[model samples]
Target: MKFDNDFFNTEVREGFEISSMMKRAWAAQMEVFQVVSDICNRNGIRYFADFGTLLGAVRHKGMIPWDDDIDISLMRDEYNELIRILPGELPYGFVVAGMYADCERLQNAAFVPQLRVIADEELWDFNDYMKYFHGFPYQRAGIDIFPLDYISKDKEFADMQKQIIKLGMEILGKWNELNREGSLDKFVSEFGQLCNVNIELREDTKNYIWKLIDKVSSLCYRDEADYVSSMALWIDNDSYKMRKKCFDDVIEMPFENFVVKAPKNYDEVLKAEFGDYMIPVKGTADHTYPFYGHMEQELIKQIRRVGFKGSVDEFCEEVASGRLRV
Candidate 1:
């Protein structure tokens, strides 16, 4: 069906005024990308622009004007290398903020594996937390980095990995006995001793479990993919379908100036994941601030159209000082 009224169902596209904020954000994003790309190029880092970012580069030459995030991926070792090299090399107000697991908010699922440099603090605030998870810096608006692990493709590895998990679950039952209670740190510290118990009991459980951990760790790395971006804000099922329908056209697009790899099966992937990719689907957002002026513009076009009634000044004031104290 065409993108007429019936099929397009959703709230306004949201945060229309945020576009100004987004523009400032996009400029910052450009800065981060240039720096990161330079580092990667100089150090021979293997990187790729994946997911929405890739799609954006392919389609918009930069960030999809309406999207709020950016993602990039690197191979396992290269990811580690980036971690090792970034702390000392970053320009200013930016650094590889390290893994969020060690942070006080360990349980906040909103915190993704990689952090980005930004001035915002929250994850959903259109002006503040607009940027959820990204690579580098601890700022609110910035790019998120992802590490791709090479999962074992073989059946044996998969089987072993599963068995190892089973054995580990058994060990977890006794974790409290060794540690105070819910301390991942304690469990890991005592992991070696537990393995000995396995050998003394002639049980393959502990040994196998450790091996699995090692393998999974060595399976390269495991982190979010860079594709969690809003490359095409206008993508409805039909538009997404068009992507798959014309996979060959998914070529290099200008990403922060240069080009990066893009998905070849854009349409197919979206269709498979969301049935019809053209519908104005519900997106992840922070409801407190505001919403788009036209979420289902095409739909609203046919139905009752309510003009936006907000302003950027109402939500947040520009950083009048032109600088933030780190």
Candidate 2:
């Protein structure tokens, strides 16, 4: 888990230097990935480095100089199996969060279907924790786990499935907005008619909608399909759609100081995702660089101002209740 200072300070690109803080964040995420890898290995489940992470592994032999997050993909059934077993298997300081995982705290922070394996731990002294971890105080770091589902071979059915998923996502967004605006009754009345189901507003309404979306995304079975894609990302782009054989086997690849699992057909996968995968396209990452540093600093200041010495979950609830002034 310890990285040499030289490694931290080295420039992966000519003009881009990895800050020590960013290096620490990368280390934290690597720990999370290791934990996940171990569990999957023990349980006979398969996963592969995905998207930017896979690109980085094949091209840079480590994290991309600018990217701050790690992504991995699992087939639908294995993804579900991981979710079912992860709760009982995680180490003391780790927790899984997602609509399906039912972790309300982190789920409310970002209502997405992709499961996040977060490093959730308490920090009684924010300064000390920050000095040691060189990352966020609360939920220190995490990795995203996206589910790859089967896509129908028939073009028409596949297109229809895509449309249904798009509509489901729109409905989920509106449901969140309406619930936030205290118009749950209105949402039920309107979308209920659209979905052709009498959805009564309840504590689990959001979960109900999430399940509906997942169900629609998984209408096609893997055994009957020629291609697989990340249903959760279909709303964004079609790059994720590829031949099922691309992930049929995995090969170990160098990633920093560790060897990690990657698809044997990584060349094809990368070419599908990013044309000319070897070319460096240095640009802003999907998230702000140094991931949570700014937000964590703000939270530390707020905690100090209010003289709060409670757990991170309690602080989150206090802020959500509108009783704490940021």
Regions of model 2 farther than 4 Å from truth: 10-12, 122-138, 174-197, 299-326
In angstroms, the error of model 2 at 114 is 0.5
Provide the overall lDDT of each model, using Cα atoms, as 2-decimal numbers.
0.43, 0.74
Candidate 1: segments with Cα more than 4 A from true spot: 1-18, 100-110, 115-139, 159-217, 220-252, 256-326
RMSD for each of the candidates: 13.0, 6.9
lDDT of 2 at 268: 83
- lDDT per residue for candidate 2 within 14-81, as digits (tens), equals 46887655676787788789999999999999999999899999999989888888999998889889
Clashes of each: 24, 0
Per-residue lDDT of 1-326 in model 1, one digit per residue for the tens?
01122211222223323344444445456556667778877897766665556545655566544565667765557766876787666665444432422243321322333434433344333322222211112243346776544434364753453344344544544644644655544444445443343232222333334333433433422232212212112122212212212223334456544566544555554454445544433343333222223332452342223332333322222212222111
lDDT score of residue 274 within candidate 1: 46
